[model samples]
Target: MIRMPAEWETHAATWVAWPHNRMDWPGKFAAIPFVFAEIIRHLGRRERVEILVRDAAMEARARGVLDRAGALSANVRFHALPTDRIWLRDSGCCFVRDGDALGAVQWRFNAWAKYDNFQQDAEVAGFMARAAGARGRRAGMVLEGGSIDVNGRGTLLTTEECLLSKVQERNPGLGREGYEKAFAEHLGIRKVIWLGDGIRGDDTHGHVDDLSRFVGERTVVTVVEPRRDDPNHAPLAENLRRLRAATDQDGRPLEVVELPLPGPLTYRGIRLPASYGNFYIANGLVLVPVFNDPNDRVALDLLASLFPDREIVGIYSGDFIWGFGAMHCMTQQQPALAVGE
Candidate 1:
């Protein structure tokens, strides 16, 4: 059993899949790689960034974007691989440690509640885990990185909307107890703190990253929308209530910090799930997604307060969210724990 660490202090590296699929972004696909490049640039300044690309051509294209953005750092590296989409946080390997040796728990990815074609994305875990110097162990259970949040101590945060939904068919026969045992054995988690639901307009069937994230050992920052008439209002409110009542593995109540949700940003007549709560904590900086909305400043200010030691920078996410996710959804972190340190 291997337990994944918290993102705040973990140190292995960051993984990202370069955007290449035209169908994913429709008429807007050309702009996504630049967004990914910006994110990579931010992460490269802190720790190693391992980018997955389909081939040499894609790698060159991605590199060109990074070079132009001046985001190319010595720590950035590329792995030429095949992928259907660019959401690495859902399909990338989830690294854990057994004392000093690194291992990976391969969760079954079903395209975020079986929403899209994911044949290549499903095989990405093994490919990425092996590349990162971890022994890949197939768990054969349906899970996504966005679906779970870890507190580094033994608690995990998740929602019923994503993990328990029948539409995903990832955990068909598995119940709560079964999932608990599986998580304990695979990811080394001792407690699973379940929330009720996720915000509306989330396409991944309620990834926890869109709703709540563990900012500290006993604290979580979640998105809150007070508009009662809005579709996301009630669900997020309920999640906030649950977070207030939930406790970690040590039986301590979580300190909940509320982040304001950006006013609905629509493109092509579709409401994109733009959120500041989807920020990714890296080695030296916190990469946050910033929509070109007024709340961008407020979200950045609040995140700066949460990550007092790290540099918090916001990338324009107005164009990125058209693909249905922001920064955290596009990358996964590999903890830097060595064997038996």
Candidate 2:
């Protein structure tokens, strides 16, 4: 049976595309590369960092920045490939393990169904699969990794706003049943915990990664807005209620933890999607996105406690979020396979 591994599980490598499409970051493009380099520096020492570059020139540029930051290391590898944006989590392959065999689920990426320049982004999965010598299979459904969180034990977390709603509908005729079947066949998901809407000002409509996540098989940490007057208060509160009543694939109660939202971060009058829930879990470290908010310490402390054995490091993302994503959005983990596989 093919099963998707949990984020906290051991990783073979982390895939990230070098930021080249400056249009995504608008006025804040120059600083985006430095942010990615900083993230790579932390991840390179832990596991392989597979970086995608559009061409040789782009790779050299990336190398210069990484070298300047003292991040160029033996653990970092580059692949020349075309890309439209830097959000690899949604565009990249979802690796699975079936016995001793490694596989890649090449889901159809439509740029969250919100953009028109995803032609190159859609091919990322297949390319990654070929590079890793994995058995590649194209999923029938158009799904993004950011839209769902799996426990690696058959349970999954997603949102109705991103999947079911007509606004930016991913699959035209596929309903909850269709999605659950796809999850079961591909990711080995048996139970699905459907949450409500996502955080406000999130471009991907309601990706669950920005709202809730599975920290463990029976543990989930979700974002909550304490201010009832805020627009995100009602939706986040409802999602928390669902999590409290939710169960895992084996019908056990889930231990729900609350993570506060980094108070509204705005750039050019637009509110960026800044949440402690967007943190990325690596092999030996957890990279969290901090927005210079008062809750930065609170979020870091809570995640540190949750991942006691793993080092927790916060990356300042005040400029990165302006591109409509953070650390988790930019990285996709490749689960390590069994020895001798």
Candidate 3:
């Protein structure tokens, strides 16, 4: 049986693309490359970092930045690949394992159905699968990696806002049954935990990575906006309520840990989705996005307690979130095969 491993599981490598589309970041594009370098530095020390660059010049530029930042390491490898954006969590492949075999679910990505320039991003999963030398399967439906979080066991967490809503309309004719069947077949999921709407400024309609994430097989850390006046308060409250009432695959109650939001972070009069729930778990580290808010300490301490064995590093994401994504959105983990394990 194929099983999609959890983010906290051992990873052979982490996939990330160099930020190129200045339009995504607007005027704040210059600092973006350095932010990526910092992320690569931390990840390269823990596990191999597979970086995707546009071409030779882009790769050289990335290397210069990495070298200058003292993040250039032996574990870092670069691949010349074209990409429209840096959010690999949606464009990259979702890897699975069955015994000693590794597989890649190449789900269709259409820039979250919000942008017109996603043809290159659509081919990313196939390239990722071939690069990892895993058996690749093209999913029959459109699904983003950030839309669903699996627990390596049999349970999966997702949001109805992302997959079901008519706003983005990822799959028109497909409904819950079609999605569940696809989940069962592609990722070996037996239980699907559906949450409500996402945060206010989420560009992908309502990606669950910004709202909730599975920290363990039966444990999840979901964001809770406590202030009643805030736009996110209602939806986040409803999601928290659902989590408290939900159960896992075997009907056991889930241990839902509440993570506080970074308050209302905005850039150029636009609200950004600055969430601690968007943290990425790598081999020996947990990279969390910090908005330089007061609650950064609270979120860090909570995640540290949850991941006692792993080092939790908070990256200043004040500018990164302006692009509507953070650490987790930019990174995708490749689970280790049997031999690597």
lDDT of 3 by residue, 1-341 (tens): 78999988889999999999999999999999999999999999999999999999999999999999999999999998899898999999999996578899999988898899999998899999999998999996799999999888889999999999999899998899999999999999999999999998899999999989999889999999889999999999999999999999999999999999988988889988899999999988899999879999999999999999999999999988889999999999999876654
Candidates 1 and 3 compared by TM-score, better number: 3
TM-score of 3: 0.98
Using all chains and alpha carbons, the TM-scores for the candidates as numbered come to: 0.96, 0.99, 0.98
lDDT, each prediction: 0.85, 0.93, 0.93
Clashing pairs in 1: 11-336, 12-335, 12-336, 99-340, 100-339, 100-340
Give the Å shift of residue 8 in candidate 3.
Answer: 0.8
Q: Whose TM-score is higher: candidate 1's or candidate 2's? A: 2
Cα-based RMSD of the predictions, in order? 1.4, 0.9, 1.1
Question: Residue-pair clashes per candidate, as listed?
Answer: 6, 0, 0
Candidate 1 has a TM-score of 0.96
TM-score of 2: 0.99
For candidate 1, write residues 1-341 as lDDT tens digits.
46788888767788888888887788887788788877877788778988888899988888888999998888988888899898988887788876677888889887876566898999899988888888778988878888899998899998887767786657777888888888898888988989877776678878899889999999899999988888988888889888899888879999999999999888778877888889999987898998778999999998898889899999998778888898899888888865557
How high is the lDDT of residue 228 in model 2? 89
Clashes of 1: 6
